[model samples]
Target: MSLLVEMRGIEKRFPGVHALRSVRFDLKPGEVHALMGENGAGKSTLMKILSGNYQRDGGEIFFEGKPVAPDSPRAATDLGIGIIHQELSLMNDLTAAQNVFIGREPRKSFGRLDEPALNRQTADIFSSMNLKLDPKAQVDTLTIAKQQMVEIAKALSYKSRVLIMDEPTAALNDAEIAELFVIIRKLRSEGVGIIYISHKMDEIKRIADRVTVMRDGEYVDTVDAESTPLSRIISMMVGREVSEKPLDVPDTRGNEVALEVRNLKRGREIRDVSFTVRRGEILGFAGLMGAGRTEVARAVFGADPRDDGEILVHGKPVSIHSPSDAVRSGIGYLSEDRKRFGLATGMNVRANIALASLDRFTSKAGVLDERGMRETANNYIDQLGIRTPSDTQEVRLLSGGNQQKVVVAKWLLRDCDILFFDEPTRGIDVGAKSEIYKLLEELAAQGRAIIVISSELPEVMRLSHRIAVMCEGRLTGILPGGAETTQEQIMELATQRESAMAPVGEVA
Candidate 1:
């Protein structure tokens, strides 16, 4: 196999960080190379260089055995390279066909709009990838899975010989993942080299031909995916031994219920989803993406309007029409999309920490007590081990893990007894994930009711005193916490969407 792409001695630098250093990466024809790294490990930085999103400070890139430098994303695309970003980039109102051919559209003889030609071309690409989606369907109308398919279609339309997918299946379900794998295999057979970046070990094992591990912006080693064990791969990525510790669920058999939901319904996503969390207990919500887990959390936290439902906190029924009402009722929700929904990126650490409980740091004259806010922020910074130069540093400047801690501090300061963590560790590194898990355990130990919504089966199995699985828009079943409950059992319940017609609190 000949090398299709080569990056030698790649180096990238920011104001205070040497993002990448002396990194070497290569891709061969007809191979799926997996990139493994911890968060902030420079995998993305290296990819950005390849896709022409960032210029390397020092590096030599060779394409097809010839030295070449791409100055921009367009230049890379013109050279048969296409990259699908970690974040979905699509116009919500535009149709799938339009998004697929946004910059490069087919024109008629007179340069008039050629709607039929565009749809037909997109339909052909969809057929080639074994995908079922109407090209005329609006992007917002499609599920996350279908939107991902559109991105893939758009990449293929560029006549790309080398394709890059960054965490493509992070939000996809098992069925959708299988469909994606089929398309990947088809592309593999066509001799298109693929660069797959993901954190899921099972995915890399199943799809990748070779695995390249990086740590702190430097290449560690490359190993054969088939022969290498998952433990070994993880060890290489983190440069340390990793443990698979099962979560410790504390006793709460007779504890009072902190939160109760009855007959909750919101659109078609959540239907009569009812559950209760005991004080000092960690209740895990387990399901695939789009399984109504987050929907239930949003409804409970009053982030979304509910068509019909009843919420009871501490045995007292409360009407929560908005997030302010939920917060006043001692409930807080940490959204899965931390950057978008949880944090005010433009604000400093102290301001973000004080956001939820501004009254505590406000004077009677409506003036902010900067001294009190700074003191509280500093306390949280020390207690939570938030990595920052000072309390006034911008929240966006911190890592994902530290930013998450800020959110946790916010809810803690607000005196929220019942907390909802939706995909709490998504986009965080492995080490940071353990820290967050420990923090959740500590919060539960302190008698705070915690509801954890996670798509990762291992996380659900490792953290919950009891597990609730949802499919489509209904709670399927709840399992007692222990080593006895396996990932397979939870997945079985997660895929049971047909049985969702039954009302909540009913055993399937």
Candidate 2:
């Protein structure tokens, strides 16, 4: 394979922050390079410079043996370089075709939007990629997995020779991830150089040819993916030998029941969902996509309406019609899409942390308690190990892991006893994931009941005291979450659905 891109001595900086320190990376034609690092390890910064999202403070970039400087995203695209961000950038209201060809839409002679032409073009791209999607369908109506495919189609439409993908499978299930792997292999076979960044070690070993590790804003080492051990790679990234710590399943049966749902029915998405979570316990919800794990969590949290159900906090039935009601009943929900539902990206960390409990910080004269808010925010930042310059820093400026921590802080500040964490470590780095797991364990030990919903079987098995499996909107089974629980057992329960039950409404 020929050299496609060579970035040497790349350097980047922000006000009072040295983001990247003389990092180096190289890519070859028909190769997938996995970038491994902790959350502030400069992997994203390096990719941003390459994609022209940010200019490099210092570096030499060579493409096809020629020096080139891409000052804008358009310039990068024109130069056959494209990036698919961790967060999907599609417009919710627009059709897939419209979003794929947004800035350069075809126009009729009279200056009208050439809708048919755009749709046909998008259709062709999808067809070539073996992606089954309607070009005219609205993006918001599509599933997260489908939307991810559309993002790949849009990036490929740019005729990209080099592609950068960040945490592409964070939201995908096992089957969806397999499909994406097929697409990635197809792209690689076509001689497209790919820079793949993900925290999943199995994925890196399966998809990447070369592995690069970065630590503390500096390059650590690079090795062949097939040769280096996953443990060694993780150690290089975190500068410490990191191993999976067994979850301590404490005796919580004697503890009081924190939250209990009985016969939770929400128009088929949640059917007869009944469960009990005790204080000082971690309950894991495991299932495939459309299996209704998230729906159950949402119904319990009062983010969505429940058709027929009874909720009990501390063995006392309570009415919960909205999120505020759930909060008042000592419940908090950290949504899977944190940027959309969990945090206000435009606001500062302190403000977002105190958002849910603003009433407690308000004075009798309607005055805001700035000092109290800051103190609480700083306390959680220190406690949770959230990486931020200050409490006043914008939430959007933090990395994915830090953003998740901020959400955790918000719910903790609100003093919720029963917390629903949907995909808690999604899009977070491996090191940061370990930290989050430790924090969750600490929370459980502190007598806060936690229900974690995740698509990753290993994660569910590692974190829960008891595992609850859902299949097709029904509670298939529950198993002990320790050594006895295997992935095969979870898969069996995940696909076990009752044929007698009527089909429920569709979920996007």
Candidate 3:
């Protein structure tokens, strides 16, 4: 394999932070190089420089044995370099074909729009990739996995020689992931070099040819992915051996029930869902994609309407018609896509934390009590150990973990006792995940009832006192969470369906 791309001595700085420091990276023809790092480890910074999203403060880039400097994304695309960002960047209202050829659509004789030709071209691209998709379908109507495939099809349309994919399977199901792997392998066979960025060790082991580890803005080392132990790669990224300890189960069973759902049903996504969480317990919801874990959480939080169900807070039935109703009933929900549903990224930390509880911060004369809000925000910042320069720092500037803590602080400020965390550690690094886990334990110890919905089986097994497995919009089974619990057992239950729902309290 010949060298296709090389980046040496890359450095980037932003205000008070040195994001990347003399990092080096390289890729060969037909190679799938996995970039592994903690959240702030400069992987994205390096890639942004490669894709011309940001200019490198200092570096030398070589493509095909020659020096190259791409001043913009367009220039990089012209140079056969393409990138699929972690956040999917597709216009929701546009058709798939329109998004695929936004600025470079085929034209008619009079320079009018060539609708049929455009759709045909888009369909051809999809066919080449073996992806079944309608070119005329609206991007918003497609599933996240389908939208991701479209992103890939768009990149391939550029005939890119070097492609960078960041967290490509973040929202994909097992089947969709398999399909993507097939496409990636096909591209690899065609000698298209791929730079794959991800946090999932199993995925890297299965797909990557080589793994490059980065820590704290510096390149650590690169090794054959299949040969290197995952623990070694993890240690390289974090600078320490991460403990693989099982969660210590506390005696929270004797605590009073904080919340209960009876016969919860919503469309076909949530059917006859029933569960209970004690005041000082963490109940884990585990399932595959589209298994209705998120739907259950949303319905319980009143973000979505429930068809036939009853919710009780402290054993008393409560009617929740809206999110406001849930909040007033002492319930809080942290959505999976925090950027879209949880935080106001443009706002400062103090403002976002105080957003849900602004009613208490307003004086009787209708004036904002800025000092009080600041004091409260500072208290939560210290308590939660949120790493921010100051409370006035924009939420968008913080790392993934700190942004999550800010969301937690918002609900805490609102005095929510029955809390739901949906994919709380979705995109955070391992170090940040440990911190979030500790914080959840602390909250549970403080007698707050917590429900955690996670796709990772290990996370659910480690965090909850009891695990609830769902399959096809129904509660399949509940298992005890401890060292005795096995992934296979949970998976089995997750794939089971109930003929008649039983009371959760009576389940073993």
State residue 44's C-alpha deviation in candidate 3, in Å: 1.1
Better of 2 and 3 by lDDT: 3
Any idea what lDDT model 3 has? 0.92
Ranked by lDDT from best down, the candidates are: 3, 2, 1
By summed lDDT, which 10 consecutive residues of candidate 3 come out lowest? 499-508
Q: Assess each prediction's global lDDT (C-alpha) against the native.
A: 0.89, 0.90, 0.92
Q: Candidate 1 residues 1-508, lDDT tens each?
A: 6799999999899887888889998999889999988877899889988998999999899988999888899999999999998789999999999999996788988988799999999999999898989999999999888999999999999999999999998778788898889999999999999999988888988999999999978999999999999889888878888785766667797889999999899988997778889899999999877788888988888888999989999999999988999999999999989989999999999999999999888889999999999999999999988888899898986878899999999999999999999999987867778789889999999999999998888888889899998988888888877786888888778888674444434221
Q: What is the lDDT of residue 275 in candidate 3?
A: 90
Off by over 4 Å in 1: 364-367, 495-508
Best candidate (score: lDDT) = 3
lDDT of 1 at 245: 72
Stretch of 10 with least lDDT, candidate 2: 499-508
Candidate 2 lDDT for residue 209: 98
- The digit string of per-residue lDDT tens for model 3 on 418-470 reads 99999999888787888899999999999999999999998999899889988
Flag the better candidate by TM-score, 1 or 3. 3
Best by TM-score: 3
Cα deviation at 76, candidate 3, in Å, is 0.9
> TM-score for all predictions?
0.93, 0.95, 0.96
